[model samples]
Target: MKITRKDFLRLSGLSFLAGGAMEAARAIAGRSSAATESQSTPVAQSVRWGMVVDLRRCQKEKGCTACTDACDAAHNVPRLADPQHQVNWIWTQPYETVFPFIQNGYAEQSDAGIPVPLLCNHCASPPCVHVCPTQATWKRADGIVMMDWHRCIGCRYCMAACPYGSRSFNWVDPRPAIAHINPDFPTRSKGVVEKCNFCEERLANGLKPSCVDACPQKALVFGNLADPNSEPRQLLRQRFAVQREPELGTGPSVYYLV
Candidate 1:
């Protein structure tokens, strides 16, 4: 009998699966070379998100509510009756309230002094992401931390893990209070933890955050910290700054100028 090249090739191919012998051999030898060859490699995506808060430009005029209003309107956050249950994605913290020492020893006392706008710092080593049992919260490739509301089991472990108290638990449904909702943003359900996304929707659309845009004084600047050419990076380099709870080692993306 004469075997043609095609027939020979076919027989050779079948030889690998000839019997239980090959399977046992492959199992003992570890992953088959063919299986390894077929594996796909992971592709890396780049995103180095960061923020800058220019305190010098921030004015106490209107109590810095512009950023809060812009953020609430954009995200459809509800106004709650009780302070404990209240959900604030981005809120203002009075200078004296946040940093009491700044005014405690100083002879000057003024309520009109500029108050800092507080939000999720979106830390480089976010403890919230680490403590989430459901993997609902995670940091994006672009350095913005995000929450997957659907995947969230409402554990609220992230809340305790965050040192800055950036995470807010949705104690009640927020949709009822939303008179007008922005289609671009999704309203979060009750039971899940939510916080600032750095206006990730806007970022994905190639736009600055609502708070950044709403600032009359342009106090807030958002850009990539990795890029020295970026506005935030340049601003940080030019000015002395501080971050909230630096002792936690979260590597907070937001910087505050005194």
Candidate 2:
């Protein structure tokens, strides 16, 4: 009689069964328990991970793809020939395009036409997780928005819910497009959604995200936002920073220092 979050998810997923998506419904039901169980454990009460990107440092070298390349190599992201089908975990976009709503006169005057690197914001209140019927995506206690590629039913609810255009769906088998498969990371099959997880696995092993480590200019700063003394927090306090679409109230963990 008490319809919990898990119950709601299962029932919602079952509705898809009426449309002949049996496997998707099963995944939604079967994973709901595990998803509910994980909700509390992985969230660190005091550690909220976040990132700060120094736009000045990042733009020192024009057309740099080191960050993107490192992420792709570490995660085994495919480099498809067709731009439309490319699986992007982290990539660059025009400055104006990145922050269309913000009226930053300083950024417009100084940093115009710069290619800003974009990735998952890992919002504190993630819309993607809420819309997912299968519980394939959820937010960790540490404030990282995570994905369970195996549990994904290709419903693309998460994709639609994400305002940043971060999630990528595998339309074709991704393995062939990867130049060199990383033995450590798993390759995704066609039909699931994938995106940056802020290097969740690497963080567990006491390492920085690949993009942060690979930046020659030391542009990307990763640390705990909850810790006031952390690099990210320190930088945020000392510099002028902005997030993408803050008006939407997603509480994006990623910030850009201009």
Give lDDT tens digits, candidate 1, residues 7-57.
999988788667667778877467446434323222442457788887778
How well is each residue in 82-113 modelled by candidate 2, as lDDT tens digits? Answer: 88888999999988888776646665876567
**Count of residue pairs whose backbone atoms collide, per candidate:** 1, 1
Off by over 4 Å in 1: 1-46, 100-104, 107-113
Q: Cα lDDT of all candidates, in order?
A: 0.80, 0.90
Best by TM-score: 2
Worst 10 residues of 2 by lDDT: 36-45
| Residue 67 Cα positional deviation in candidate 2, in Å, after optimal superposition | 0.5
- Which number leads on lDDT? 2
